[model samples]
Target chain A: MTIRYPNGKKYVPVRTSKSQKLKNPSFSNRGKSLEDELNESNDYYLSRGIAVIHKKPVPVQVVKVSYPARSAARITEAYFGTPSTTDYNGVWKGIYVDFEAKETKIKTSFPLNNIKEHQIQHMQNVTNAGGFAFLIIKFTTLERYFIVPFEMVERKWDRMKAGGRKSITLLEFENTSVEVQPGYIPRLDYLNAVETLMKLYDDKIER
Target chain B: MTIRYPNGKKYVPVRTSKSQKLKNPSFSNRGKSLEDELNESNDYYLSRGIAVIHKKPVPVQVVKVSYPARSAARITEAYFGTPSTTDYNGVWKGIYVDFEAKETKIKTSFPLNNIKEHQIQHMQNVTNAGGFAFLIIKFTTLERYFIVPFEMVERKWDRMKAGGRKSITLLEFENTSVEVQPGYIPRLDYLNAVETLMKLYDDKIER
Candidate 1:
């Protein structure tokens, strides 16, 4: 990288071009995407007596507020707040549950990069605290959803740090995951998956 | 309320005045009012895994938006959307729960006018579907919080509609209420009250 001071002094890069992008890749919802579908599913769950889980609203932090005469306050400067937890967390049947729902079109494997460091840490904390923690990874192109345990994720995460594979393959997903049936009334009746999760939690408790 | 169009004209009471007065009540957090304390208590509840409940953000429907820059969109006009449900709802100990949290300062009684018609209907729906529905009414002047059952609310609502008293007396609040100890976390840890609620719901299910 090169830089110049106000005096017009310039410097050139002595750095390696090892592929790190500064710009954030936008996840645009081109038309109605899986997020929209999940929103509908959430609404369906709320309407029926199945579950009550809501996607947290995009967090906004107001820095400068302007309360003009006879007008609503205008926020001039603000930035997105980093969520300390997963995108969703709720209780069902006395079980404290937390998870991130994701979808990608890649066919062969799911990239470990799709999961963030903070998210992995959050999942670890929840699991350690005797709560159910997992991910809803949906292969968009393949029309498949898998419930992958965070315990499995932790091992893979350590390997990736040690220069191992940077992703979880399709085979691993098929073998170590449970499928959630998407229905009409309660849409993604995830409580069923939660039932399976409860058994795992109970077994852990017993152990 | 009277208004003039482009031409000189007058009208009856406007539909918005009551809503505006209800919403923008000058909430003076003077030396920490009951509302302020409860809000803080709710925050305490959320952080400690005691209960999960939040005041719903006001619903705003944007009519026209101006995109003036890449990252800024200015809303031109927005109206309040009719909220069908109560202010708060969540799960507690494997039991489905929903409730409206309200505050009143009248020393004599809780005004029935403080309870809305649609809210009563929503509570009825929640109760019918095997959920614990309730109200957490804080008498500000008295510094007392009461857990009022939805069944009692339903009966009171019936009386109000039939041209009875516009509110319930302090005696009524005393007779059919569960007192909650005001605390820092889980402000109204109505679980003590939930025990009473659970019995009622469980008996109905057993029948």
Candidate 2:
């Protein structure tokens, strides 16, 4: 299947051979990491004065260490830190933007466990403040992606807690969202999706 | 020495115990640590819903750990991670807030090195998007606290880069900032200082 909208030349991100084993089956275009692609796309957007977006820095936690000999102290103990906030947050054309990018192999639906309680709350707060908040779900197995707003997610999440299915089925997501074309510079051209969400929610403040 | 602020309660947080020696003079609360006081103040502000502020969890790079059969996993090695953002970022009332709190025992001034290049960029981006951005400075030797806006900071920083003095002295900060009277509940009632800054900036978005 071919994408109709964006046709820009993109640089494919190379995947570290170590991580290829964990990637979703059928998705092999792992040339550049998501962070690098997003950074490049953000620079492109920024220089043109089109929109401003940034990828939040990685979160790291360090523990005990030793400096006995005359050499650099070695990190001996540490773990990944949980970000209390989203991975990316910024303003685009006068609108507050907050989003998280995720890759999954499941072809039928996305799992709810990928979303955390604190992140849900953060998105809720963002939407409550009249900000544009959503997630970019990349279905690596199906070679597809969907951009869903908080409102749709809130509905599904509430129903799930009320004894419904734990995950959002592929059918439901496809029926609700518009497809986005993946480009070399921007792995997922999500602004097109944001445009859709903004239209639905009313775009009085957006330029 | 005691000073009353007409609110019918003590303004300064008294020393709980004056006996033990604090090895780190940067923390000059005598018997109390700066982190403790900051936590106490954040809690007070949070409970009243006046503001929601939190310290960004510190970044650590863990390298090795040993599992002890009789107890928890022992962290054997770790090191600090270079954080690209500020120490704290959150919302106060309706205005998005970003800040860094620091203490210096030196009597002359606080070192500019305390503010990292990435952190300055983050603050600049935050403020450019129309949010409240500043740093809280605690000079332990002088027993003074000052809230300096990022705009002023960036200006001074640019000058320093052009072969000027490396830092803003205590005298310069005192002349430019509001001295936040300490409190029992929220040790440093920062929002009060924020309120003053808001009036100066004349931003209508308030709590």
Candidate 3:
């Protein structure tokens, strides 16, 4: 039941070593999967009646299957299908919250290639629909996470297409994005940053 | 791959034949899949900048896979996983929209067994979050569709569990639920029915 990445790399669940944990107890979950942490945070929010966000399941096209005696049916042939939207979405304080999360080992910059074109378009649609859309990006090496609103990302995305840098520098990300500090129970509490964006939206409406 | 229902019945994509088409021009998509129609309607809304609804992909647990070519990889073994949430959700008119769609061939009543317990709980969660949640049910035999809000459905669900009727009669459904007349371009035109519910919500808020 091993799942590999599309690039043929073995999908390993990152775990902090005992020595590393001892060295930095605060960042014990430094190398762990951002997706897993986000799922945990979502569960925490759901339990506390905070939000109802969920990660969309991976799309696959099944071509063949088999049924063994006294066993469950198994798909024998399938291929990954392109997703039409972003990863996570739900209702937060009666607001539609839509977002995508990604982690990169590189410390200097976050590559735009990590994101797909359709996902960007989907975020734009969410924004146009008056939904809160953003990206939760994690720098694995730096053990930092930030929430970048769709508007900011769209500006940089458009810039990249017009003979600009292929990636967003760490300096630029730190300046434009809201830094989300990791926590024990929720793991990655990005909602706090969402509240800030909510205030900004409210203020805009007031003006 | 061939898919089968939990009851061991093969999953067949319903299609309207020439004879059926000739019989009912309005119900031209009589036997076609409801999921496909919903997808088309979602696409229509997306293109027109109306709403941003999407169907969540079916979750599958991959057990084994093989790389046949340098670029193409095939899943050799997998199994369908139970979904944690409903099939479709998005933002509509600054409101969180969540729903599950089902089609039944029975003419008299709609079976409660068509929906799982978790799905009911999920819909309740959506409602509690101040989001719009409902079911798009199609009675295939009569070619009739209805949007049953979670509150009404929840009452019936609780009643069934307390030794009440195991199914909702067509008479009850027609009276309680919002009837959605099918259209040409979007096909389902369920949003029009949604507007009725929206008005009811707005009136309640004013009071």
Candidate 4:
């Protein structure tokens, strides 16, 4: 069975290949998708009682459905709806946390076009409302993930809108964004970066 | 077009009656559903820069989909998945706000069975994390709405689990819950109740 979005893009299930499986028998999810890793990390966070965060489900506008059984209704026609906010959001340490995660194959630069204008506006609103807002960008080729604060993104977005570079280069991203190392159990330990950013934000407020 | 959930309930769009329409031509959504009212109130809140809240989209597990055109793909088979958390959550005045909304026709008492165990647990978790968590209960017959804090519900849930009454009486609810009157523009001005709760919470913390 296969699932496709309204845009006709096939939804590929995250799975390990036979060759990769054979090479790394002990590590099954070594090459799993970014979403899978983040989900595992969130589960780890929840289990340990550290934080409660969840990825918002993909919004779908269902037009038709059929009830074959009392407990099994099948959606026959649905259209994907545009998300008004980011993908992930939850409460952390008495504060609201909101962010969007994206992966790119390009190693040179992270394209700003990957994020929508409404998302940036939403992040701005969150920040203004005294919540933590950021982006989790993953460079698939380099296998590196970084937490880019909304302020950094806002600056870059404004620069781009003012006829500057459309994308932030690898060096610029490395300097501005906080890199998060992947781990075995949690997979992507992004909260450490959040903790660091929170301290920095607090320090700035004090100054 | 009709959409059915896995529980065999058809999704009905909220519509005003012909008589209601004729009686109040100025008021378009006079007899809209609870969900519709909530959505409109959320929109009002967002537009006014008061808060940012959204109802989580219904989660569905898609089994099969077909692409009829490049721009449009239709889900042929899917099933509704159980939500792990409440329907609505967002940031308000630098605090995390989370709540579940339910409507009941029973005028004497509100049934505890309307709320799931996981939802109760989730609300507990939110409150523990220093976030605001509550339930918006609407008694359809009485045409009254109340914001019942998780602490109140938790107390009742515990007593019920210990072999007490399975429902909370209307008098008890009236005494414990913060009543919120319905309005025309926002329909359900829930945040007014939230504001009062916040002050009470702050006062308790100060003490």
Q: Tell me the RMSD of model 3 versus the true structure.
A: 8.3
Which candidate wins on TM-score?
Answer: 3
- DockQ of each model vs. true complex: 0.07, 0.21, 0.52, 0.45
* Candidate 1 lDDT over residue span B104-191, tens digit each: 8777788888888888977776666555678888776666778888888788889878887788787887788777876645445666
Residue B37 error for model 1, in Å? 2.7
- Please give the C-alpha DockQ score of model 2: 0.21
B-chain TM-scores per prediction: 0.74, 0.78, 0.83, 0.83
Q: What is the per-residue lDDT of model 4 for residues A1-207, given as tens digits with 9 covering 90 to 100? A: 779989999997544476755422334346577888899999888777777899999998898988886667878888778899999999866778899999887889999999999999898888776678999998876777898888988999999999998998889878878898878888888988988876764432221
For model 3, the superposed segments whose C-alpha errors exceed 4 Å read: A1-27, A201-207, B1-27, B201-207
Instruction: Give the whole-model CA lDDT for all candidates, comma-separated.
Output: 0.64, 0.68, 0.84, 0.82
Residue-level lDDT for B161 in candidate 3: 99
lDDT of 2 by residue, B1-207 (tens): 677779977787443344333223334355555566777887786666665455766556555667878865655776666765676655554456678778877789878887888878867666666656788888865667888877777888898889887888888887776678776667888888978977775453532
Q: What is the DockQ of candidate 1?
A: 0.07
Q: If you score just chain A, what TM-score does every candidate get?
A: 0.74, 0.75, 0.83, 0.83
- Per-model TM-score, in order, reads 0.61, 0.73, 0.86, 0.85
Superior candidate under lDDT, 1 versus 4: 4
| Alpha-carbon lDDT of model 3 | 0.84
List model 1 lDDT by residue over A15-130, tens digit each: 23433111112223223345665677767755664444555543444445557789775555544455555776544443455678887778889999988998897676566555
Candidates 1 and 4 compared by DockQ, better number: 4
Off by over 4 Å in 2: A1-28, A31-61, A68-70, A79-83, A91-96, A128-132, A202-207, B1-54, B60-79, B202-207
lDDT of predicted model 4: 0.82
